[model samples]
Target: MDAIVALHQRVSQSRLTAPAPDSIQLDLLMRSAARAADHGNLQPWRFLIIEGEGLIRLGQLFARVAAAKKPDITQAELDRFTAMPLRAPMIIVAIAKCQPHPKVPEIEQVIAAGAATQNILTASFALGLGAIWRSGEMAYDDTVRQAMGLSNNESLKEQILGFIYIGTPDADARPARQINPKDFFSTWTGE
Candidate 1:
């Protein structure tokens, strides 16, 4: 497939099915993720792949967090929270490791991580896999972060970037609304 078309077709997938991506596919995806552009060659991104029993554990953690925060949450809501990780056959937790570089600012390092994440999504799409990037309470919660062995210098406000779920689409994903380029473009003339 053409690179432009492959990139344009990449969409956030929320509905995925059984038979997670095989080891070979994962190897390719990881290699593709490593190809993301980085300033100063500081690869400040880390990916944690979670699936199988790990998904169940993640679901439980989400449920625990939800219940602790919202004691009055209904069983349905709890179930929903618990099942979030199970929605996809594979989930990659993307973390931004901030390593101070004299020549590279902290923000740039973080941006490199974000770029790596985009690469992961794009690669998944190119491989005919569905993908979605998600982050919420789990990414911010101290307890949840510890559960996943993620360290965040809260004082610095540095933490996990987000979660990228990848798998085969169980159902068709609704394409995002076409965006108008005009809304974001403006002529810049040095006067």
Candidate 2:
């Protein structure tokens, strides 16, 4: 697919299935992510690729976190949390590893990581694969961060931007929602 078309038409695929991207495709996705806009070249991001048994382990972690939060969590709720990671064959955990940079603030580094994630999503669409970026309470939980080997420190910011789920689309790609550029874009002038 043309790059422009991919950028314009990419849409999140919620219903995904196996098999996940092959090694070559995964490499392409990573390369694309590395090309995201980075101010001062502060490459403040890392990704964790999870698949196969790893997905099960991630699901377990999710369930564990949920149970810890609510001791009264029922079996059905635990099962729901456990099955979250099984929605896709593969998951790429995007982490923003923000470090102190004289030129780039922490927020810029985080945005760079987010751009990397967007690149991954666009590349997945271009490669004829399905993907969705997800984040919720689990993302901000310190336990989940520690489980992912990320720092839980309040000063040295390290955060999970999202969990990018990748696989074959269970259904056809939905049409991209149309929006008028005029609504969001306008000329800025000194008034």
Candidate 3:
């Protein structure tokens, strides 16, 4: 698909199903992420690709975190948390590995990582795969960060930008909502 078309039409697919992207498509997705804009060439992004059993493990971790936060969490709530990662056949954990730099701030590094994730989303759409970028309280939890191998130490700050779920779109997937550029665009002029 044309880059412009993919950029314009890409929509989040929350109701994904099995049959994730094949190896070739996965390769393209990662490559697209590498093309994201980086300030000072910090290249401060890393991705953890999870599928099959790994998704189950991630779901379990999510449930654990939920239970820890709320000791009174019911069985059904725990089960719901455990099933979160099962919504898609694959998940890519997008991380921003921020490093100290004279010119580049931590926020820029995080934004770069977010752009990398956006690239993956657009590439997935172009490859005819469905994807959604998601993040909840678990994303900001320190325990979850450690579980994902991200350190919250003094020198280096690593953060989970989002969990990108990818797979085939369910048959009942909703259509993308129409957007008008005029509603969001504005011209700036010197007074």
Candidate 2 lDDT by residue in tens digits, 41-71: 9788999999999999999999999999999
What residue runs in model 2 are displaced by over 4 Å at the alpha carbon?
Answer: 152-156
> TM-score for all predictions?
0.90, 0.97, 0.95
Quote the positional error of residue 46 for candidate 3 in Å. Answer: 0.5
Please give, for residues 1-191, the per-residue lDDT of candidate 3 as tens digits: 99898888788888899899999999999999999999998889999999999999998999999999999999999999999999999999999999999999999999999999999999999898999999989888898899888977777889999899999989644666888999999998987
Candidate 1 local lDDT, 1-191, one digit each (tens): 57797777678888888767888889988888788888888788888999999999999999999999998999999999899999898899988777667898889888888998998888887777888899987877888878877656632334688889889977776775688789999999988
lDDT values of the candidates? 0.84, 0.94, 0.92
Model 3 regions lying over 4 Å from their true place? none
True-structure Cα RMSD, model 2? 1.2
Candidate 1 C-alpha error for residue 77, in Å? 2.2
Q: Which consecutive 10 residues in model 1 have the weakest lDDT in total?
A: 150-159
